[model samples]
Target chain A: MNYNWNWGVLFEEQYLNWLISGFGWTISVALSAWCIAIVIGSLVGVGKTVPNKIVRGICATYVEIFRNVPLLVQMFIWYFAVPEMLPEDWGRWMKRDLPNPEFVTAVVALGLYTASRIAEQVRAGIETVPPGLSAAATAHGLSTAQTYRYVLLPISFRIIVPPLTSEFLTVFKNSSLALTIGLLELTAQSQQIAEYTFQGFEAFTAATVIYVCIALVATILMQVLEKYTRIPGYVGKEA
Target chain B: MTDFDFNVIWSSLPFLWQGLQLSLLLTLLSIIGGIVLGTLLALARLSGIAPLAIVAATYVNLIRSVPLILVIFWFYFLVPLALGRPIGGFYSALIAFVLFEAAYYSEIMRAGIQSVKRGQVHAGQSTGLSYWQIQRYVVLPQAFRNMVPILVTQGIILFQDTSLVFVVSLRDFMTASSIVARTEGRLVEMYLFAALVYFVICFSGSMLVRSLKSRMAT
Candidate 1:
């Protein structure tokens, strides 16, 4: 079978508009969810490593529940099922006050889920440090809080940079599930445009390329960081 | 926040039951299909055949790097267009989940299979078994036993990901809860319940897998 290809369709004004508008929503969702992930994951990751037994248990519970479940299911639970249980006024507030509840719900769910994995990454990073490092900081006039801030966290963050970058990519891809709630992000926009234009392959191909490019750039950046941050023994392992 | 709604729970029982069926069916078929495809891909990679390894690696990296939803949508939207064939919604989704899951499982199996040591293969030669026989009798059985925990872990992941089929309007438990939420107008309650279901399913599956791993170790 023979087929004709239309490269012009991609650069047309209408398709460009869709791409621009869709990217705006996509970036907003990704950034917001990423922020949430950073906050929750940092806290829980530290919590898991804390001396307090209760805090460690709580963090473990959180990680197990969220990390093992699917992002799509979590998004659904946030978008469709959760509001019904809210108090009447609060429920109405969630439905009406949120400018785009779809975006908000997606961010919250995806962020929380990704945060669990990030928590593990953070913990792994922290544990990778020598045990006496924190003690040395404490003995050398660093407070308990200062010990982590000054000595533990900085080194751990550098060490875990590669896995942390992978976590970010995972979160980025997962943000597309927000489309199911009708947020009109990149994936949703492409699908909608494809439906309207009947150029399904073209629209999805663009989406695929964009995703691949973003991931490639992120992976390269991570490798560079790893090289620069090389802690002598760990450098040049060809990850 | 209002108290627990016993009435809603009682009324939604049958709907929840139906959703359970769909979730189970999707989870089982996807895991099985994934295992078959993943084994083939793993074998191809381990074969040390350059082209086959390249193809297998490409498949794993491409799918694993993308979002699961994109894979699902790719199958939903592009299958009929590419093949000129009509497929059912369930099968379309099964295909997507299988393809995605295979990428993960293949990687896991590849690691497990490779760690069997080169000496183990030569040892099989002393017994006079063919290469395929060695794989089936000596390699795969032990590999599969050790492979069970990873398989179980991947299985739990696939079970949870079955919710992605909801994007195409398949009434899985999560979708069913959303429909209930729309009618009831209680977002938090419905969602919390949905999360509860996911937590229970995944947590129990993981616990089972962990115990099985320990049992195997013994």
Candidate 2:
């Protein structure tokens, strides 16, 4: 069989547009879900840190449910089953009232699943803030909440920045899973492009390059962020 | 008025059993293929040759960064388009899944190799064992023992990851559930049945890995 290589196929306009649009969808999912992850993970992390039995139990159960289940199954449940369980008008509202129900379900599923994992990271980060700082703040007569805001949180966020970057990469990679529910993310778009051009290698190689670039950019930005927050030898510079 | 009919489970027993057989075969074949390929890839990454190392690293990283669904799609959709050879769905899915699982396992094994003490190598050399023999005798046994837990954890994760095959429309447990749901119009029961299937296989695998880990530590 004489095989022809088609490296130049993606330079064509239609294929280029397919790649660009797929990325637009992927980045939107990553950013939207990142917002949700930050908020939800922080809350659950704080709850995990709380001394109260009920609060810790609630946080643990949340983590267990979201963490143990496969994200694809969670997406399936969110897209198909959860809507059916909603109140009649509510289900209709979710199905019809939302623009891009696929996007919403993808965002919610990816966000919730990733948030559980991040909650564990956040809890570890928050816990790593030296106990002395918060104790000192409380001794200085700050309220408990004030102690957390003034002393604990800032340190923890800085400590967690590198790991937080990793979580971001994972969320970005996992956003590809959304394509199964028919979100036109990078994976889905690459498939569609390949279908049209039969340039499978070119489309997939482009997608791989895109993912590597994102991960590389993330690593670079994370390094910059680490520098901005630098207190030399603060955590002994190991991380 | 509302109860899960155990009888629906009984009637659907044959279908679920079929899914179980397929799921077991898929997992087993992929695990075997993955173990062999992943171990080699792991060794390749640790090999002294620069180009070989780069190739191994790139394979793992590229495969890992993309979703397994996409990998499966490549085989399921594009193989026919790209190659004149027509591969059946199950074997195609099996091949893709094995490749995907190998990337992660190989990554884990690479870490395992690095974690072995450098002194063990020198010691083995001093004892007059050849380099290949050193790896077989001194390095691999220790690395494998140290990595048993992680290998098993990866196994469980890979087992869960097998569910991604549904994207390629393979009739694994998840797809079987959908089929049962369609024919019997019992979505809830079918899913519950599927979940149970997953739980039993994964839970047992976890326990075995745990126990094996404890045994190896001794």
Candidate 3:
């Protein structure tokens, strides 16, 4: 109860700058990883529904492996273990020559982890599409690939917008874990601020507020996207 | 380019087992605590009292909006400061996980509760049961049954998240692996072993949930 309460240290130039840079890194990491997640996740998701057993099996295995492991452990494996497992020259380059190795590793780790979850969402979204529509597309002389590309994917992606929004928000939150691998993202910067000023409460409170704000803005934007993408006369699972 | 060293992992089994036990303990304690607190929050939100519902909603939303790691840091500082002395890492982590997971569990509980039919409540009321009795004897059993698979899914996530205690230097499974990796100079082997263990446990847990879901559907 007697601890000193100093809020001023948060606005000081160095700490403020740290927070800003940290925010930038968080956005950078989340966005870059999300790009990776959405692209690969959509492919794997669609692949899971393909007729080829081997492709479906590979996609399922990817989801199982990636989703099962913790992101922190995966990050560690990428940051510390994978490099050593690579060829000597490649490993040395990754260790010493690769720029922003921590950031890159964090992105790849988080992206792959998030992808598995997104894949599940995408699969569910696709499955939610009424079976008759896919049949109609096929019955209309559409090739299997064309059926998916034109009919299945468009509808599935729209249906999944809501879940994808949550996943997008999750990417930002999980970006905080990048701190474990020495990426100076928002959480790490706040921890740094706390360390330098001993104002842990103020520092973390700021980080919490920033995170809440990011989540709020992201939610609102995604809601708008959801509204825009709503298929007329279509009732989803909730309905 | 060292050959795969099963010997290092075999020799470190005791230490690793100790860490895995701690991780499981944390997961168990947090799930129990979170579900209990979360049920209260869910009930408060569904209670139809405006202020109570708003307060519960705000708490759940705020907690859900932030990352679990930040909450862990917040309590790691706040608990010691508030108590006038430090509680050790395990207790602090436990407190944080309970509070954070409560928010998630609240949402799941809310869905489960709502999934119980309105007709059942009316049936209980016609039988002269009080509100609490209706909830206790009628709605809750079905809600809990419906929620079992999802609750297990959340527990699996909790188990994976327990590894985040590594930030606090807690010797959870991941942290223990890293320590042995450092000491033995076998980072690749140690980390791969850790990942494999986590995969086995979590994969099996998810598979169980899938089976439970199918059974429930039937």
Candidate 4:
């Protein structure tokens, strides 16, 4: 009951700059990781459905390992453990010569973790597609690759937009974990502001507001994308 | 590369086990607390009262919007200041996890409740049962059964999240591993071992949920 509250400290020049830069890092990390996630996730997802048993097993193992491990642990492994596991010169380069090691390590860790989740979604999306479509594509003399490329992926991607949107939102939120490895994203910046000013409540409130705003905007944008991509008479359309 | 050391892990077994116990304790307590509070929030949202529903919905959405780390920070730093005394890291982290996970648990509970047929409620009504009686004797049993797989899945995620208490310097498993890694200079061995332990527990948990889901479907 005796603590002082100073909301104004958040707007002071130095604090404001920290928040801005922190916000910048958060967005950059999330977006870059998202790009990696979607691309790799889709491929791994498609790999899970391939005819080769070994390929499917490999894909399944990837999803299990990445998805099961905690993101914070994974971050540490990437930042501290993986480098040393590499050959001597490469390990040295990773530890000492890599530019922005913290940032790069964070992006790679977050991306790989999110990729596993997204791969699961993508796999579900593909599996839920009517088997008749694939059968018909083959009946039309389409190669398996052609069938998947031209028929399966487009419909599966549309079917999964809603789940994908939530996962996208999650990546942004999970980007906060970057602070664990020394990347000063929004959450880290807010904590720093709280430390410097002794105004913990105001600092956290500002961070919360910014995060909520980001989620709202992202939700709205994804809704719009969902609307544009709606499949006529699909299950989600009425809902 | 320096020779890998299995001896360090064997030596630190007691410390690691202590940390693992704390992580499981936090996860267990938070899951219980989250489900209890979440069930109430679900009821409030489904209640006919407009303000109650809106407030419940807003709470769920707002909490869902932010990272758990920020909420953990809020409780760790601000709650003590507001209350005029520190509650220490463990309690603050526990409170934060409970509140944060409740938002997610509420949505799951709401879906489970809604999945029950409306006719079931009407059947209870025709039997002259009170609303609370109807919910208690009829709806909730079915809802809980329907939600078991999802609840377990969420519990697994909550277990993973308990490691985030490292931010407050609480000696959970992840933090314990990091501490030993630092002091013993065995970052590679310690962290990889930590990851392997988590993988085994969580991967098996998910496998259990998967079997449960399949059984439900059958």
lDDT per residue (tens digit) for residues A108-212 in model 3 = 999999999999999999999999999999899999999998999998898889888989999999999999989999999999899888999899999999999
Candidate 3 is scored at a TM of 0.98
The CAPRI quality class of candidate 4 comes to high
- Per-residue lDDT of model 1, residues B36-112, tens digit only: 89988998998989999999999988887777877887888767766777777777888888899999989888887
Worst 10 residues of 2 chain A by lDDT: A230-239
- Indicate whether candidate 1 or candidate 2 has the larger DockQ: 1
Q: Looking at candidate 2, what is the lDDT of residue B174?
A: 70
Which residue ranges in model 2 land beyond 4 Å of their true spot? A1-9, A127-152, A234-239, B1-10, B77-84, B192-218
Residue B75 in model 2: lDDT: 75
lDDT by residue (tens digit), candidate 2, A56-80:
9999878766765567677777886
- Which sections of candidate 4 miss by over 4 Å? none
Q: TM-score of each model's B chain? A: 0.92, 0.90, 0.97, 0.98
Across residues A124-148, which tens digit of lDDT does each residue of candidate 1 receive? 9899888889889878998878888
- DockQ leaderboard ranking: 4, 3, 1, 2
Overall local distance difference test of candidate 3: 0.94
**Candidate 4 chain A lDDT trough over 10 residues, lowest sum:** A230-239
If you score just chain A, what TM-score does every candidate get? 0.89, 0.94, 0.97, 0.98
Candidate order (TM-score)? 4, 3, 1, 2
For candidate 1, the per-residue lDDT at B125 reads: 98
Report DockQ per prediction, comma-separated.
0.50, 0.33, 0.87, 0.88
With a 3 Å backbone cut-off (N, CA, C), the pairs that clash in candidate 2 are none
What count of clashes does model 2 give? Answer: 0
